[model samples]
Target: MYSLTLEQDNRATVSAAIHSDRLVVACLCAAWCGTCGSYRTSFETLASKHPDMVFLWVDIEDHADIVGDLDVDNFPTLLIQRHDTVAFFGTMLPDPAVADRMIQSIAELPDAELQRQAQSTAERRTWQSECNLRQLLNAPG
Candidate 1:
Protein backbone atom coordinates (compact mmCIF):
# COMPACT_ATOMS: atom_id res chain seq x y z
CA MET A 1 0.00 0.00 0.00
CA TYR A 2 1.39 3.38 -0.96
CA SER A 3 -0.66 4.54 2.03
CA LEU A 4 0.38 7.24 4.47
CA THR A 5 -0.91 9.14 7.47
CA LEU A 6 0.26 12.60 6.44
CA GLU A 7 2.55 14.33 8.93
CA GLN A 8 5.32 16.92 8.90
CA ASP A 9 8.00 14.25 9.14
CA ASN A 10 7.01 12.51 5.89
CA ARG A 11 5.89 15.34 3.68
CA ALA A 12 8.11 14.42 0.75
CA THR A 13 7.01 10.78 0.63
CA VAL A 14 3.31 11.60 0.80
CA SER A 15 3.80 14.38 -1.76
CA ALA A 16 5.41 11.93 -4.12
CA ALA A 17 2.47 9.53 -3.83
CA ILE A 18 0.07 12.39 -4.46
CA HIS A 19 2.02 13.16 -7.62
CA SER A 20 1.95 9.56 -8.77
CA ASP A 21 -0.49 8.14 -11.31
CA ARG A 22 -2.26 5.95 -8.77
CA LEU A 23 -5.72 6.78 -7.51
CA VAL A 24 -5.46 9.01 -4.43
CA VAL A 25 -8.10 8.68 -1.69
CA ALA A 26 -7.60 11.39 0.88
CA CYS A 27 -9.71 11.83 3.98
CA LEU A 28 -9.55 15.50 4.95
CA CYS A 29 -10.29 15.91 8.62
CA ALA A 30 -9.30 17.82 11.74
CA ALA A 31 -7.82 16.28 14.86
CA TRP A 32 -10.20 18.12 17.14
CA CYS A 33 -13.39 16.90 15.55
CA GLY A 34 -15.07 14.05 17.42
CA THR A 35 -16.55 12.67 14.22
CA CYS A 36 -13.15 12.66 12.62
CA GLY A 37 -11.73 10.80 15.56
CA SER A 38 -14.38 8.11 15.29
CA TYR A 39 -14.02 7.79 11.55
CA ARG A 40 -10.26 7.31 11.68
CA THR A 41 -10.38 3.59 12.23
CA SER A 42 -12.71 2.92 9.33
CA PHE A 43 -10.56 5.05 7.07
CA GLU A 44 -7.56 2.92 7.90
CA THR A 45 -9.40 -0.32 7.28
CA LEU A 46 -10.54 1.06 3.95
CA ALA A 47 -6.94 1.94 3.14
CA SER A 48 -5.81 -1.54 3.98
CA LYS A 49 -8.39 -2.95 1.58
CA HIS A 50 -7.11 -0.82 -1.27
CA PRO A 51 -3.42 -1.41 -1.11
CA ASP A 52 -3.05 -0.81 -4.84
CA MET A 53 -4.11 2.80 -4.44
CA VAL A 54 -2.71 5.56 -2.27
CA PHE A 55 -4.74 6.37 0.85
CA LEU A 56 -3.93 9.52 2.77
CA TRP A 57 -5.14 10.68 6.13
CA VAL A 58 -4.85 14.46 6.12
CA ASP A 59 -5.51 16.47 9.26
CA ILE A 60 -6.62 19.79 7.84
CA GLU A 61 -5.05 21.69 10.72
CA ASP A 62 -1.75 19.90 10.39
CA HIS A 63 -1.60 20.19 6.60
CA ALA A 64 -3.40 23.49 6.17
CA ASP A 65 -0.63 24.69 3.95
CA ILE A 66 -1.77 22.12 1.40
CA VAL A 67 -5.50 21.63 1.96
CA GLY A 68 -6.56 24.90 3.58
CA ASP A 69 -8.19 26.38 0.50
CA LEU A 70 -10.37 23.33 0.23
CA ASP A 71 -13.10 25.29 2.03
CA VAL A 72 -14.07 22.32 4.07
CA ASP A 73 -17.45 23.18 5.59
CA ASN A 74 -17.80 19.86 7.33
CA PHE A 75 -15.88 17.17 9.10
CA PRO A 76 -14.48 14.10 7.29
CA THR A 77 -14.39 15.45 3.77
CA LEU A 78 -13.15 13.15 1.05
CA LEU A 79 -10.93 14.04 -1.90
CA ILE A 80 -10.95 11.28 -4.49
CA GLN A 81 -8.73 11.67 -7.53
CA ARG A 82 -7.13 9.89 -10.44
CA HIS A 83 -4.07 11.51 -11.96
CA ASP A 84 -5.03 15.14 -12.59
CA THR A 85 -8.78 14.68 -12.36
CA VAL A 86 -10.65 15.40 -9.19
CA ALA A 87 -13.37 12.79 -9.50
CA PHE A 88 -15.05 13.50 -6.19
CA PHE A 89 -14.64 16.07 -3.42
CA GLY A 90 -17.17 16.78 -0.73
CA THR A 91 -18.26 15.94 2.78
CA MET A 92 -19.27 12.31 2.96
CA LEU A 93 -21.17 10.48 5.65
CA PRO A 94 -18.86 8.95 8.23
CA ASP A 95 -19.86 5.54 6.99
CA PRO A 96 -16.98 3.38 5.84
CA ALA A 97 -19.28 1.41 3.59
CA VAL A 98 -20.24 4.55 1.74
CA ALA A 99 -16.62 5.63 1.42
CA ASP A 100 -15.64 2.21 0.13
CA ARG A 101 -18.42 2.26 -2.41
CA MET A 102 -17.30 5.70 -3.50
CA ILE A 103 -13.73 4.58 -3.99
CA GLN A 104 -14.87 1.74 -6.19
CA SER A 105 -17.32 3.82 -8.19
CA ILE A 106 -14.95 6.70 -8.82
CA ALA A 107 -11.90 4.57 -9.52
CA GLU A 108 -13.93 2.67 -12.09
CA LEU A 109 -14.44 5.77 -14.21
CA PRO A 110 -11.92 6.58 -16.90
CA ASP A 111 -9.89 9.76 -16.61
CA ALA A 112 -11.58 11.31 -19.62
CA GLU A 113 -14.97 10.64 -18.06
CA LEU A 114 -13.90 12.13 -14.75
CA GLN A 115 -12.52 15.22 -16.49
CA ARG A 116 -15.74 15.59 -18.42
CA GLN A 117 -17.80 15.49 -15.23
CA ALA A 118 -15.50 17.99 -13.58
CA GLN A 119 -16.54 20.44 -16.24
CA SER A 120 -20.13 19.26 -16.59
CA THR A 121 -21.64 21.33 -13.81
CA ALA A 122 -20.88 24.57 -12.02
CA GLU A 123 -20.27 22.80 -8.71
CA ARG A 124 -18.07 20.18 -10.32
CA ARG A 125 -16.17 22.84 -12.26
CA THR A 126 -15.34 24.50 -8.96
CA TRP A 127 -14.05 21.19 -7.69
CA GLN A 128 -11.74 20.91 -10.67
CA SER A 129 -10.30 24.30 -9.90
CA GLU A 130 -10.37 24.32 -6.12
CA CYS A 131 -10.23 20.69 -5.03
CA ASN A 132 -7.56 19.38 -7.29
CA LEU A 133 -5.33 17.67 -4.71
CA ARG A 134 -2.29 17.36 -6.91
CA GLN A 135 -2.45 21.05 -7.69
CA LEU A 136 -2.88 21.73 -3.98
CA LEU A 137 0.13 19.57 -3.13
CA ASN A 138 2.22 21.40 -5.72
CA ALA A 139 1.35 24.84 -4.36
CA PRO A 140 4.18 26.85 -2.80
CA GLY A 141 4.28 26.36 0.94
Candidate 2:
Protein backbone atom coordinates (compact mmCIF):
# COMPACT_ATOMS: atom_id res chain seq x y z
CA MET A 1 0.00 0.00 0.00
CA TYR A 2 1.09 3.60 -0.58
CA SER A 3 1.70 6.12 2.10
CA LEU A 4 -1.69 7.24 3.33
CA THR A 5 -2.22 10.93 3.95
CA LEU A 6 -3.45 11.77 7.40
CA GLU A 7 -7.21 12.02 7.57
CA GLN A 8 -9.97 10.88 9.89
CA ASP A 9 -10.19 7.34 8.51
CA ASN A 10 -6.45 6.87 8.08
CA ARG A 11 -5.85 8.15 11.57
CA ALA A 12 -7.78 5.19 12.91
CA THR A 13 -5.77 2.85 10.73
CA VAL A 14 -2.54 4.30 12.09
CA SER A 15 -3.77 4.38 15.66
CA ALA A 16 -4.53 0.67 15.61
CA ALA A 17 -1.42 -0.30 13.66
CA ILE A 18 1.01 1.50 15.95
CA HIS A 19 0.05 -0.77 18.80
CA SER A 20 0.48 -3.90 16.71
CA ASP A 21 3.67 -5.60 15.55
CA ARG A 22 3.76 -3.62 12.32
CA LEU A 23 6.44 -1.06 11.69
CA VAL A 24 5.19 2.50 11.30
CA VAL A 25 7.09 4.82 8.97
CA ALA A 26 5.84 8.38 8.78
CA CYS A 27 7.15 11.28 6.71
CA LEU A 28 6.30 14.64 8.17
CA CYS A 29 6.05 17.18 5.38
CA ALA A 30 4.05 20.14 4.28
CA ALA A 31 1.92 20.40 1.14
CA TRP A 32 3.64 23.56 -0.02
CA CYS A 33 7.08 21.98 -0.07
CA GLY A 34 8.37 21.30 -3.58
CA THR A 35 10.75 18.64 -2.40
CA CYS A 36 7.97 16.87 -0.57
CA GLY A 37 5.78 17.00 -3.65
CA SER A 38 8.47 15.43 -5.79
CA TYR A 39 9.36 12.93 -3.12
CA ARG A 40 5.81 11.66 -2.65
CA THR A 41 5.91 9.15 -5.47
CA SER A 42 9.17 7.66 -4.28
CA PHE A 43 7.84 7.42 -0.76
CA GLU A 44 4.73 5.62 -1.98
CA THR A 45 6.78 3.23 -4.06
CA LEU A 46 8.84 2.41 -1.03
CA ALA A 47 5.66 1.81 0.89
CA SER A 48 4.38 -0.52 -1.78
CA LYS A 49 7.56 -2.54 -1.52
CA HIS A 50 7.09 -2.99 2.19
CA PRO A 51 3.46 -3.74 2.68
CA ASP A 52 3.97 -4.90 6.24
CA MET A 53 4.89 -1.42 7.32
CA VAL A 54 2.45 1.42 7.85
CA PHE A 55 3.60 4.50 5.95
CA LEU A 56 2.08 7.90 6.61
CA TRP A 57 2.27 11.34 5.07
CA VAL A 58 1.69 13.81 7.83
CA ASP A 59 1.28 17.45 6.77
CA ILE A 60 2.45 19.39 9.74
CA GLU A 61 0.42 22.43 8.84
CA ASP A 62 -2.77 20.44 8.44
CA HIS A 63 -2.23 18.22 11.47
CA ALA A 64 -0.53 20.61 13.82
CA ASP A 65 -2.40 19.28 16.82
CA ILE A 66 -1.17 15.73 16.27
CA VAL A 67 2.31 17.05 15.52
CA GLY A 68 2.27 19.31 18.56
CA ASP A 69 5.56 21.17 19.20
CA LEU A 70 7.78 18.61 17.53
CA ASP A 71 10.86 20.19 15.95
CA VAL A 72 10.54 20.06 12.19
CA ASP A 73 13.07 22.39 10.64
CA ASN A 74 13.14 20.54 7.34
CA PHE A 75 10.48 19.46 4.87
CA PRO A 76 10.66 15.68 5.14
CA THR A 77 11.22 14.50 8.66
CA LEU A 78 10.89 10.78 9.33
CA LEU A 79 9.49 9.01 12.33
CA ILE A 80 9.93 5.23 12.46
CA GLN A 81 8.40 3.40 15.32
CA ARG A 82 6.92 0.11 16.48
CA HIS A 83 4.62 0.18 19.44
CA ASP A 84 6.10 2.38 22.18
CA THR A 85 9.63 2.18 20.86
CA VAL A 86 10.51 4.99 18.49
CA ALA A 87 13.22 3.42 16.36
CA PHE A 88 14.13 6.60 14.52
CA PHE A 89 12.98 10.21 14.29
CA GLY A 90 14.69 13.06 12.47
CA THR A 91 15.00 15.00 9.26
CA MET A 92 15.96 12.94 6.24
CA LEU A 93 17.19 13.61 2.77
CA PRO A 94 14.46 13.50 0.13
CA ASP A 95 15.88 10.29 -1.28
CA PRO A 96 13.59 7.27 -0.99
CA ALA A 97 16.45 4.80 -1.09
CA VAL A 98 17.77 6.12 2.20
CA ALA A 99 14.38 5.67 3.79
CA ASP A 100 13.97 2.22 2.31
CA ARG A 101 17.31 1.15 3.71
CA MET A 102 16.52 2.58 7.09
CA ILE A 103 13.20 0.78 7.29
CA GLN A 104 14.79 -2.49 6.29
CA SER A 105 17.53 -2.17 8.86
CA ILE A 106 15.29 -1.09 11.68
CA ALA A 107 12.69 -3.75 10.94
CA GLU A 108 15.34 -6.42 11.25
CA LEU A 109 16.29 -5.36 14.74
CA PRO A 110 14.88 -7.34 17.64
CA ASP A 111 12.41 -5.53 19.86
CA ALA A 112 14.96 -5.53 22.63
CA GLU A 113 17.54 -3.98 20.34
CA LEU A 114 15.13 -1.31 19.26
CA GLN A 115 14.32 -0.56 22.86
CA ARG A 116 18.04 -0.42 23.64
CA GLN A 117 18.87 1.90 20.76
CA ALA A 118 15.89 4.07 21.62
CA GLN A 119 17.42 4.92 24.98
CA SER A 120 21.02 4.34 23.93
CA THR A 121 21.50 7.79 22.44
CA ALA A 122 20.58 11.15 23.90
CA GLU A 123 18.94 12.06 20.61
CA ARG A 124 16.93 8.84 20.58
CA ARG A 125 15.92 9.29 24.20
CA THR A 126 14.64 12.69 23.16
CA TRP A 127 12.60 10.97 20.49
CA GLN A 128 11.04 8.72 23.08
CA SER A 129 9.97 11.70 25.19
CA GLU A 130 9.30 14.27 22.51
CA CYS A 131 8.87 12.75 19.06
CA ASN A 132 6.89 9.63 19.81
CA LEU A 133 4.00 9.35 17.37
CA ARG A 134 2.07 7.04 19.69
CA GLN A 135 2.12 9.65 22.41
CA LEU A 136 1.62 12.62 20.11
CA LEU A 137 -1.22 11.20 18.05
CA ASN A 138 -2.98 9.69 21.05
CA ALA A 139 -2.67 12.66 23.35
CA PRO A 140 -5.76 13.70 25.32
CA GLY A 141 -7.48 16.77 24.03
Candidate 3:
Protein backbone atom coordinates (compact mmCIF):
# COMPACT_ATOMS: atom_id res chain seq x y z
CA MET A 1 0.00 0.00 0.00
CA TYR A 2 1.31 3.41 -0.92
CA SER A 3 0.03 5.72 1.82
CA LEU A 4 0.12 9.47 1.20
CA THR A 5 -0.77 12.30 3.50
CA LEU A 6 -3.01 14.82 1.81
CA GLU A 7 -1.85 18.38 2.20
CA GLN A 8 -1.86 21.44 -0.01
CA ASP A 9 1.61 20.68 -1.33
CA ASN A 10 0.84 17.03 -2.09
CA ARG A 11 -2.37 17.48 -4.05
CA ALA A 12 -0.53 16.64 -7.22
CA THR A 13 0.63 13.30 -5.81
CA VAL A 14 -2.93 12.43 -4.95
CA SER A 15 -4.04 13.54 -8.39
CA ALA A 16 -1.52 11.20 -9.93
CA ALA A 17 -2.77 8.29 -7.83
CA ILE A 18 -6.34 9.04 -8.90
CA HIS A 19 -5.31 8.72 -12.51
CA SER A 20 -3.45 5.45 -11.92
CA ASP A 21 -6.56 3.23 -12.03
CA ARG A 22 -5.79 1.56 -8.72
CA LEU A 23 -8.13 1.31 -5.74
CA VAL A 24 -8.14 4.46 -3.62
CA VAL A 25 -8.66 3.87 0.11
CA ALA A 26 -8.97 7.15 1.96
CA CYS A 27 -9.38 7.58 5.68
CA LEU A 28 -11.14 10.83 6.45
CA CYS A 29 -10.17 12.04 9.89
CA ALA A 30 -9.66 15.16 11.97
CA ALA A 31 -6.47 16.12 13.79
CA TRP A 32 -8.19 16.67 17.10
CA CYS A 33 -9.88 13.30 17.33
CA GLY A 34 -8.18 10.92 19.75
CA THR A 35 -9.55 7.89 18.01
CA CYS A 36 -8.19 9.12 14.74
CA GLY A 37 -4.80 9.71 16.27
CA SER A 38 -4.67 6.18 17.63
CA TYR A 39 -6.03 4.69 14.44
CA ARG A 40 -3.43 6.38 12.26
CA THR A 41 -0.78 3.76 12.96
CA SER A 42 -3.16 0.94 12.31
CA PHE A 43 -4.25 2.63 9.11
CA GLU A 44 -0.65 2.80 7.97
CA THR A 45 -0.06 -0.80 8.88
CA LEU A 46 -3.13 -1.71 6.90
CA ALA A 47 -1.76 0.32 4.03
CA SER A 48 1.48 -1.63 4.08
CA LYS A 49 -0.48 -4.85 3.78
CA HIS A 50 -2.08 -3.71 0.53
CA PRO A 51 0.71 -2.21 -1.52
CA ASP A 52 -1.32 -1.99 -4.70
CA MET A 53 -3.87 0.43 -3.28
CA VAL A 54 -3.46 4.11 -2.60
CA PHE A 55 -4.17 5.06 1.00
CA LEU A 56 -4.83 8.68 1.87
CA TRP A 57 -5.11 10.41 5.20
CA VAL A 58 -7.33 13.41 4.75
CA ASP A 59 -8.02 15.74 7.64
CA ILE A 60 -11.48 17.18 7.23
CA GLU A 61 -10.57 20.44 8.93
CA ASP A 62 -7.35 20.84 6.99
CA HIS A 63 -8.78 20.10 3.54
CA ALA A 64 -12.27 21.48 3.93
CA ASP A 65 -12.58 22.53 0.32
CA ILE A 66 -11.94 19.01 -0.95
CA VAL A 67 -14.33 17.37 1.48
CA GLY A 68 -16.75 20.19 2.23
CA ASP A 69 -19.85 18.47 0.88
CA LEU A 70 -19.15 15.28 2.80
CA ASP A 71 -21.16 14.94 6.00
CA VAL A 72 -18.61 13.12 8.13
CA ASP A 73 -20.50 12.85 11.40
CA ASN A 74 -18.08 10.49 13.08
CA PHE A 75 -14.41 9.89 13.54
CA PRO A 76 -12.39 7.69 11.12
CA THR A 77 -14.72 7.90 8.16
CA LEU A 78 -13.57 5.90 5.12
CA LEU A 79 -14.01 6.61 1.43
CA ILE A 80 -13.06 3.71 -0.86
CA GLN A 81 -13.24 4.19 -4.60
CA ARG A 82 -12.08 2.56 -7.81
CA HIS A 83 -11.54 4.90 -10.73
CA ASP A 84 -14.55 7.25 -10.63
CA THR A 85 -16.93 5.00 -8.73
CA VAL A 86 -17.19 5.19 -4.94
CA ALA A 87 -17.61 1.63 -3.72
CA PHE A 88 -17.96 2.42 -0.04
CA PHE A 89 -18.20 5.65 1.94
CA GLY A 90 -19.12 5.90 5.60
CA THR A 91 -17.88 5.91 9.16
CA MET A 92 -16.04 2.71 10.03
CA LEU A 93 -15.13 1.03 13.26
CA PRO A 94 -11.71 1.87 14.63
CA ASP A 95 -10.61 -1.73 14.18
CA PRO A 96 -8.04 -2.29 11.47
CA ALA A 97 -9.00 -5.90 10.97
CA VAL A 98 -12.55 -4.91 10.17
CA ALA A 99 -11.32 -2.37 7.71
CA ASP A 100 -8.98 -4.87 6.11
CA ARG A 101 -11.79 -7.37 5.68
CA MET A 102 -14.11 -4.78 4.26
CA ILE A 103 -11.51 -3.71 1.74
CA GLN A 104 -10.94 -7.29 0.60
CA SER A 105 -14.66 -7.92 0.17
CA ILE A 106 -15.26 -4.78 -1.81
CA ALA A 107 -12.21 -5.32 -3.94
CA GLU A 108 -13.31 -8.83 -4.80
CA LEU A 109 -16.59 -7.74 -6.36
CA PRO A 110 -16.93 -7.65 -10.12
CA ASP A 111 -16.82 -4.24 -11.77
CA ALA A 112 -20.29 -4.62 -13.22
CA GLU A 113 -21.80 -5.43 -9.82
CA LEU A 114 -19.97 -2.61 -8.15
CA GLN A 115 -21.30 -0.24 -10.77
CA ARG A 116 -24.79 -1.61 -10.24
CA GLN A 117 -24.60 -1.04 -6.50
CA ALA A 118 -23.17 2.41 -6.96
CA GLN A 119 -26.41 3.51 -8.61
CA SER A 120 -28.84 1.05 -7.08
CA THR A 121 -29.98 3.37 -4.32
CA ALA A 122 -30.18 7.05 -3.47
CA GLU A 123 -27.40 7.02 -0.86
CA ARG A 124 -25.12 4.97 -3.06
CA ARG A 125 -25.79 7.27 -6.00
CA THR A 126 -24.93 10.21 -3.78
CA TRP A 127 -21.60 8.54 -3.07
CA GLN A 128 -20.89 8.38 -6.78
CA SER A 129 -21.43 12.15 -7.06
CA GLU A 130 -20.12 13.47 -3.77
CA CYS A 131 -17.62 10.93 -2.45
CA ASN A 132 -15.70 10.28 -5.62
CA LEU A 133 -12.13 11.47 -5.04
CA ARG A 134 -11.35 11.62 -8.75
CA GLN A 135 -14.21 14.01 -9.41
CA LEU A 136 -13.46 16.03 -6.30
CA LEU A 137 -9.82 16.40 -7.25
CA ASN A 138 -10.74 17.43 -10.78
CA ALA A 139 -13.52 19.80 -9.81
CA PRO A 140 -12.81 23.49 -10.36
CA GLY A 141 -12.09 25.33 -7.18
Candidate 4:
Protein backbone atom coordinates (compact mmCIF):
# COMPACT_ATOMS: atom_id res chain seq x y z
CA MET A 1 0.00 0.00 0.00
CA TYR A 2 1.19 3.52 -0.81
CA SER A 3 0.66 5.23 2.52
CA LEU A 4 1.27 8.96 2.77
CA THR A 5 3.88 10.72 4.93
CA LEU A 6 2.56 14.18 5.55
CA GLU A 7 4.21 17.01 7.44
CA GLN A 8 2.37 17.99 10.61
CA ASP A 9 2.07 21.41 9.04
CA ASN A 10 -0.12 20.21 6.19
CA ARG A 11 -3.59 21.15 7.36
CA ALA A 12 -4.26 22.71 3.99
CA THR A 13 -4.19 19.26 2.42
CA VAL A 14 -6.20 17.64 5.18
CA SER A 15 -8.76 20.42 5.09
CA ALA A 16 -9.00 20.15 1.31
CA ALA A 17 -9.87 16.48 1.64
CA ILE A 18 -12.71 17.46 3.97
CA HIS A 19 -14.24 19.21 0.98
CA SER A 20 -13.90 16.19 -1.30
CA ASP A 21 -15.20 12.59 -1.53
CA ARG A 22 -12.17 10.63 -0.34
CA LEU A 23 -11.69 9.06 3.06
CA VAL A 24 -8.71 10.11 5.20
CA VAL A 25 -7.16 8.03 7.96
CA ALA A 26 -4.74 10.17 9.91
CA CYS A 27 -2.60 8.27 12.35
CA LEU A 28 -1.20 10.52 15.06
CA CYS A 29 2.04 9.04 16.30
CA ALA A 30 5.34 9.98 17.82
CA ALA A 31 8.72 8.84 16.52
CA TRP A 32 9.70 7.42 19.88
CA CYS A 33 6.52 5.49 20.51
CA GLY A 34 6.98 1.73 20.61
CA THR A 35 3.32 1.19 19.81
CA CYS A 36 3.66 3.32 16.73
CA GLY A 37 6.65 1.26 15.59
CA SER A 38 4.84 -2.00 16.16
CA TYR A 39 1.77 -0.86 14.26
CA ARG A 40 3.46 0.37 11.09
CA THR A 41 3.17 -2.83 9.11
CA SER A 42 -0.38 -3.44 10.20
CA PHE A 43 -1.29 0.12 9.34
CA GLU A 44 0.25 -0.26 5.91
CA THR A 45 -1.57 -3.52 5.35
CA LEU A 46 -4.86 -1.94 6.31
CA ALA A 47 -4.13 1.01 4.08
CA SER A 48 -3.77 -1.39 1.16
CA LYS A 49 -7.17 -2.84 1.94
CA HIS A 50 -8.72 0.61 1.59
CA PRO A 51 -7.04 2.08 -1.45
CA ASP A 52 -9.69 4.68 -2.08
CA MET A 53 -8.86 6.30 1.22
CA VAL A 54 -5.82 8.42 2.00
CA PHE A 55 -3.74 7.01 4.84
CA LEU A 56 -1.40 9.37 6.64
CA TRP A 57 1.15 8.76 9.40
CA VAL A 58 1.85 11.97 11.23
CA ASP A 59 4.38 12.43 14.03
CA ILE A 60 2.71 14.55 16.68
CA GLU A 61 5.69 15.86 18.64
CA ASP A 62 7.40 16.96 15.49
CA HIS A 63 4.36 18.65 14.06
CA ALA A 64 3.00 20.44 17.07
CA ASP A 65 1.12 22.98 14.99
CA ILE A 66 -0.92 20.41 13.13
CA VAL A 67 -1.20 18.30 16.26
CA GLY A 68 -2.61 21.33 17.99
CA ASP A 69 -5.48 21.31 15.53
CA LEU A 70 -6.29 17.67 16.37
CA ASP A 71 -6.57 17.61 20.19
CA VAL A 72 -4.42 14.49 20.17
CA ASP A 73 -3.26 13.63 23.69
CA ASN A 74 -2.37 10.02 22.99
CA PHE A 75 0.61 8.44 21.28
CA PRO A 76 -1.08 6.40 18.54
CA THR A 77 -4.55 7.56 17.60
CA LEU A 78 -6.62 6.91 14.49
CA LEU A 79 -8.98 9.51 13.09
CA ILE A 80 -11.23 8.28 10.30
CA GLN A 81 -12.67 10.69 7.80
CA ARG A 82 -15.12 9.96 4.97
CA HIS A 83 -16.39 12.33 2.31
CA ASP A 84 -14.24 15.00 3.92
CA THR A 85 -15.87 14.44 7.30
CA VAL A 86 -14.79 12.42 10.32
CA ALA A 87 -17.12 9.43 10.68
CA PHE A 88 -15.27 7.35 13.27
CA PHE A 89 -12.41 8.11 15.65
CA GLY A 90 -10.47 5.66 17.83
CA THR A 91 -7.08 4.62 19.20
CA MET A 92 -5.91 1.06 18.84
CA LEU A 93 -3.26 -0.28 16.57
CA PRO A 94 -4.18 -2.43 13.60
CA ASP A 95 -5.68 -5.31 15.53
CA PRO A 96 -7.48 -7.27 12.82
CA ALA A 97 -10.66 -7.72 14.84
CA VAL A 98 -10.85 -4.06 15.82
CA ALA A 99 -10.05 -2.95 12.30
CA ASP A 100 -12.82 -5.17 10.99
CA ARG A 101 -15.28 -3.65 13.41
CA MET A 102 -14.27 -0.13 12.49
CA ILE A 103 -14.66 -0.92 8.81
CA GLN A 104 -18.08 -2.47 9.29
CA SER A 105 -19.34 0.36 11.47
CA ILE A 106 -18.11 3.10 9.17
CA ALA A 107 -19.56 1.37 6.13
CA GLU A 108 -23.05 1.85 7.53
CA LEU A 109 -22.78 5.45 8.74
CA PRO A 110 -25.02 8.13 7.25
CA ASP A 111 -23.87 11.59 6.19
CA ALA A 112 -25.59 13.10 9.20
CA GLU A 113 -23.46 11.01 11.49
CA LEU A 114 -20.37 12.03 9.64
CA GLN A 115 -21.27 15.68 9.92
CA ARG A 116 -21.91 15.44 13.64
CA GLN A 117 -18.66 13.61 14.26
CA ALA A 118 -16.72 16.09 12.20
CA GLN A 119 -18.16 19.06 14.00
CA SER A 120 -17.41 17.57 17.39
CA THR A 121 -13.83 16.87 16.35
CA ALA A 122 -13.35 20.38 15.02
CA GLU A 123 -14.73 21.94 18.15
CA ARG A 124 -12.47 19.96 20.48
CA ARG A 125 -9.23 21.45 19.22
CA THR A 126 -7.62 22.38 22.51
CA TRP A 127 -4.02 21.12 22.81
CA GLN A 128 -2.84 22.41 26.13
CA SER A 129 -0.13 20.23 27.61
CA GLU A 130 -2.01 19.86 30.88
CA CYS A 131 -5.36 19.13 29.28
CA ASN A 132 -7.12 15.89 30.16
CA LEU A 133 -5.87 13.28 27.71
CA ARG A 134 -8.84 11.03 28.36
CA GLN A 135 -11.03 13.47 26.54
CA LEU A 136 -9.60 12.37 23.19
CA LEU A 137 -9.99 8.64 23.49
CA ASN A 138 -12.66 6.94 21.39
CA ALA A 139 -13.66 3.32 20.87
CA PRO A 140 -14.52 1.90 17.46
CA GLY A 141 -17.92 0.71 18.64
Clashes of each: 0, 0, 2, 1
Alpha carbon lDDT of residue 98, candidate 2? 89
Q: What are the C-alpha RMSDs, in order, of all predicted structures?
A: 1.1, 1.4, 0.8, 7.7
Q: What does the lDDT read for residue 106 in candidate 4?
A: 76
Return the TM-score for each candidate structure. 0.94, 0.93, 0.97, 0.67
Rank order by lDDT, top first? 3, 1, 2, 4
Question: After aligning candidate 2 to the native by TM-score, how far in Å is the CA of 89 from where it should be?
Answer: 0.9
In model 3, where do residues sit more than 4 Å from their true spots? none
lDDT of 1 at 51: 86
lDDT of 3 at 87: 94
| Native-referenced Cα lDDT, model 2 | 0.87
Error of 4 at 22 (Å): 1.2
Error of 3 at 21 (Å): 1.6
Candidate 2, pairs of clashing residues: none
lDDT of 2 by residue, 5-61 (tens): 887657777677776678999999999999999988888999999998888889899
What is the lDDT of every predicted structure here?
A: 0.88, 0.87, 0.92, 0.59
TM-score of 1: 0.94
State the lDDT of candidate 3 residue by residue for 33-66, as single tens digits: 9999999999999999999889999999999889
